[model samples]
Every structure is written in C-alpha cells, then in structure tokens.
Target: FLICLFGLLSHYSDISDMSVYYSISVFSILGMAIIIIYVCISISISIDERYPDEFMNQDQEMYFPIHITDD
Candidate 1:
C-alpha cells in the first residue's frame, strides 16, 4: 500500500494535465480502498474464527463438492 502511495505521490508533480491527474488519482484511490477493505475483512474473519463463540453465527457453510464421472 505504501509502495503504491509513494509511487503515485512521486508522479503527482509530473502530471501537467489536470484531466490525467484526476483520472489517475481517482483510480489510485479506488484501488487502495479495495485493497484495504479486503485486507481488513480477511483479518477480521481470521480473528473471529479464532474466537469461534464470538462469531459462530458469522460462519459460512459450503455445499458438497462436485464430482465428475466418465461419460
């Protein structure tokens, strides 16, 4: 995250066109937001699993695995 942030910041001053900078900034912000959100959710789930009683209701169940037979 810091890597991407730094990379974007370093290119900030070089953008002579406002439109280009605006687009880049928008995409960068969105990408960072998604990455952060995913990481946070995954961490939360891990912690919740560690304390099962605190998050048992949040657990998810998977259906049976698909098996293929020869034709």
Candidate 2:
C-alpha cells in the first residue's frame, strides 16, 4: 500500500508541478515513519528476549561440540 501510494504520488507530481514539492515532503515523511516504526518494533522484541523470567525455562546455551577420535 505504501509503495503504491508513493508511486502514485510520484506520477502525480510529474504531471502537476504545483504538487511536486508537497509530494516530496509527504514521501520523505512516510519513509521516515516506516523506518522509525521498524526500529522501535525490533528493539522492543530484542529487549523482551534479553530480559527473561527466572522461572521460565531458558533455551540451552550454545557450546562447541567436541569430537573424539578412537585410536
């Protein structure tokens, strides 16, 4: 939806010079909003995973698998 709106506005701007400036402003704002939202959501998820409850079963920690050779 955002991509389609952006493209429509871009085409509209090309035909109508008057709306070109405003279209650019709107486009930039939309782009920034999307980026801000993405960053916030990712950070929140990471924070949730990092701070776990003591009672909750935790995932096993990663360890290097040892290989043994029998002579």
lDDT of 1: 0.65
Each candidate's number of clashing pairs is 0, 0
Summarize candidate 2's per-residue lDDT along 10-30 as a digit string, tens digits. Answer: 665346755755766787788
Cα lDDT tens digits, model 1, 1-71, are 54665566557676566656566678778988999999999999998776554444333323323334359
Residue pairs with backbone atoms closer than 3 Å in model 1 (clashes):
none
Measured over all alpha carbons after superposition, the RMSD of each candidate to the real structure, in angstroms, is 11.5, 9.6
What would the TM-scores of all predictions be? 0.50, 0.50
Against the hidden true structure, what lDDT does model 2 obtain? 0.64
lDDT against the true structure, per candidate, is 0.65, 0.64
